[model samples]
Target: MIALDIENVTKSFGGVRALTGVTLSLNEGERLVLLGPNGAGKTTLFHSISGNILASSGRISLFGDDITQLPPDARARLGLARTFQITNLFAQLTVLENILLAVCGAQKLTFKFVRPLDRYDDIQKRARALLEEWNLVDAADRLVRNLSYGEQRQVEVVMALSGEPRILLLDEPTAGLSPAETLRVMEMVRKLPRDMTIVMIEHDMDVAFEIADRIAVMHQGRVIAEGDEAAIRGNQQVSDIYLGVE
Candidate 1:
């Protein structure tokens, strides 16, 4: 089944086009990567899909249901979750607390103030399990502000996964990581459930080739080439335009 469908999508800001007639479909459990140089509209495409930025033209559907007009929060409620290119966390909150907040947000309990957060034992249990799975249990009590850059990124990912999203959109998830840290993050990403659709924007060819079942190369706001990793690597157009290979 198709997890996400983008057809004829286009976006422009004040006469400057960021994306033009972009189209793609991601199947359930598919691990796809978007490859592009800087300014290639990779992030813009992610925003369009996640509803952070609305597409000026074209249709977006999740699991066969059109969500082109839905707001970002609404899309989140519909099983769409995304992590930003930069880490986003509640700096003042503990790692566990950050995950808890994400749980509350996903459950639409943001308005419930009278109830003690501890009232959700099941939620806490699940959050703890996620922390442990992501190797952040040891740092769960630490304030996000105090954790190392890589650790902070792990927390952000845990928070994104806390929602149990059906479709996961990760924007440059391995950005700012050292080579070792980048490999670690990619390993965790590879461990995600096979039923969840994942689409990530990555500039690291090694990382993208390692984890992506398929690759889509974006250049100047359009998909110039897309195929399995081997095919993409071999494509002359992809090599010349994006990979900078002769």
Candidate 2:
């Protein structure tokens, strides 16, 4: 089944266009990596899909349902989750508290002012399960601000998973990590359920090739090449853009 369909999407900022007629599709449970030089419109496409920014022209569908007009929250409710290139978390909150808040938000329990959050057994259960399942119990009580950068990235991924999303968009999940930290994240991603579809933007060539079932190379607001590892590896345009090969 097609999990996401982005057809003829475009995004413009005043006189400049960030994405131009970008079209891509992902199958259910497939892993797609977006490869590009800086300013290739990778993040812009992500924003469009996640509803952070609306496309100037085109159609986006999630599971055959047109979601081009939906807001971010509405899309979240429909099983879409994403992580930013930067860490998005409550620095002062402990890991457990952060997970609790994410669970509450995902379940839309933030408006329940009459009931204390702790009183919600279901929410607490879900948070605890997430911590245990992700092997984050050891740092459950530590402040996010106190955790290492790599650990914080892992926490962000766990938070994204709290909603049980069918499709996940990750923007540079291992951007600033050390080699060891990168390996840890790669292992974590490898352990994800095979049923979850993932689309990621990665600058690390090794990481991109290792995790991607297919790759799409973007350059100057367009997808210039796409295929499996071998096909992408041999594409002259991709080589010219990234490796300066003739």
Candidate 3:
């Protein structure tokens, strides 16, 4: 089953091209990682899929439904979710509170301020389960601002999961983390429900290859090579650009 389909997608900023006729498809429940050097248009492809930016040409479909021009929030409402390369979370909110907000937002209850946060019994239960699964139950009440950087990033992941997205785009989820912290995140991602599809952009070679079922290598605004780990490791072109031959 195909969960995502990108056909000849392109993005241009005036005369400069960010993504050039990129075409790719992702299967349901597949863990796909995008590998490339900086400015390779990896993030540009992500932004296009997430509806953060419009593609200059071509179409993007989610679960067989055309969503090329769908606005970001509309796409999100239809079970598409993504995280940024940088951490984006509510710093003033507690870990539990942040999850609660995500649940409420996903349910279109964000404007329902008439009731207290605790009144949403179902959302609260879901939030607690996420906290337990992410192993942050002990810090449920800690404000995100007070947690360590790694912990905060975990909270970001928790919030993204709280919505139960069908397809999740993780952009550099472990970027800037210490080696130990990165392994902790790797474990978390490994434990995620297998039914959820993940398309991730990761610069960590070890982590990227370890978790990826297939990898798409982007270069100069296009996908130069795509295959399983062994094929990617042996590709001459991929070695020339992103992976140094040495």
TM-score for all models, in order of appearance: 0.93, 0.95, 0.92
Report the C-alpha lDDT of model 1 over 54-132, residue by residue, as the tens digit: 9999999999889998899888877889999877888999999999888867766234444565558767887888888
For this target, which candidate reaches the highest TM-score against the unseen true structure? 2
TM-score, cand. 3 vs. native: 0.92
The pairs that clash in candidate 1 are: none
Instruction: Summing lDDT over every window of 10 consecutive residues in candidate 1, give the lowest-scoring window.
Output: 109-118
State the C-alpha lDDT per candidate: 0.87, 0.92, 0.87
lDDT of 3 at 26: 91
Can you write out model 3's per-residue Cα lDDT over 150-183, one digit (the tens) per residue? 8887888878887789899999988888888898
Report how far residue 229 has shifted in candidate 3, in Å: 1.0
Task: Write out the backbone clash pairs for model 2.
Answer: none
Overall local distance difference test of candidate 2: 0.92
